[model samples]
Target: MPIDIKQFKEASRPLSERVLGFLKDHPEQAYSLMELMAELEGKADAASMAWIVAIERMSGKKEGSATLNKYSKALEELLKQGKVTEAQLQGTTYYAYGGGHP
Candidate 1:
């Protein structure tokens, strides 16, 4: 069945937020797309999964391949806007808050 865009947007909100939060907590370390997806799957809804698949298809990529690319892009934008910083991490590459350690 085709997924509704509005529902997808709603579902994606928390997933995106989670992704950003993870990045903010672990700035220096890199993660595979699969790893991130695995982490996301634990908490995301079907709509969130749809977005992940869409991004994966658009990138012509597999799990964990483009994970950092997407993450870096989001982080770069946030950094540029002064909403976040690279100094947030001490040395960790992965972080989970309330969602459990990844």
Candidate 2:
């Protein structure tokens, strides 16, 4: 469901702030955008980002984890930037570490 109008009233702020406001108003819920961010984001060093990617791989137990929609988001981000490189052979995605192209 979309955020209520009252929620959007407070959503004009930056994303972290908007999420904060949303959580404050509705502490019982969770949202997708919140899960989409990699831990530490830009602050993470290369090694750390790789570790996070591994963790996300191992720990994905959410409803969308098994769906193409969820993995597509991850594939998009990886295609953009990450220690993990992706390549498709036939229909399967293959991943490997290091700066080399997959």
Candidate 3:
């Protein structure tokens, strides 16, 4: 199932909630930030205008170095809240919902 970021945004939910819901809905799969972005935007590429807008709204960073930076912040917030956990493999981070610490 494809997700629509715009719809979530329009629903007046915070980005973190949207993200958590996505992860919760797919508890068995781990996702990278870009993969999560792609899934949220319903696109293969994470650089689309829709993605940029959605990310900006989520991060409140008007001029960030990169979307990944903001996304990382959101992911870190989730980690702190215990809504998500991450695993590092070969210097790459993968995030998943639940299962406590990764």
Candidate 4:
């Protein structure tokens, strides 16, 4: 049988929620890959970003990024959608939630 859209959405929900939740809780923190994974309670793999992207894809989410550039693009889209916000720090950029562009 074909997969149901609701099931797919449900599976991807946790990944998206975890990511957004992390940014929301740590608006001022500049998290590296390791730190991000730890905050998400995900495996601290060197390829944690890639792994998360893959998992998201498998769950039927259109957001998948195996590289920093792709991740940034995806996050930018999320920001535009008002699901997240961007912050500038020492010439660097960060993502946060609840429209708090700190």
Best by lDDT: 3
- Clashing residue pairs in candidate 3 are none
Candidate 2 per-residue lDDT, tens place, 52-75, comes to 555666786564333334434644
Candidate 1 C-alpha lDDT tens digits along 1-102: 887896577557744466666655776644434455555555355456547667777886655436445655654555465544343245533332322233
lDDT for each of the candidates?
0.53, 0.42, 0.73, 0.57
Q: What is the lDDT of residue 73 in candidate 1?
A: 67
Q: List the candidate 2 regions with Cα displacement exceeding 4 Å.
A: 1-66, 99-102
lDDT, candidate 2, equals 0.42
Error of 4 at 1 (Å): 27
The alpha-carbon deviation from the true structure for residue 42 of candidate 1, after best TM-score superposition, in angstroms, is 4.8
Q: Rank the candidates by TM-score, best first.
A: 3, 4, 1, 2
Best by TM-score: 3
**Model 3 over residues 3-101: C-alpha lDDT tens digits?**
589775644766677678888889999987778877865676645744665666678666663655656777888999898989987876788896444
Q: How does model 1 fare in lDDT?
A: 0.53
Q: What 10-residue stretch in candidate 4 is worst by lDDT? A: 63-72
Q: Between prediction 2 and prediction 3, which has the larger TM-score?
A: 3
Greater TM-score among 1 and 4 belongs to: 4
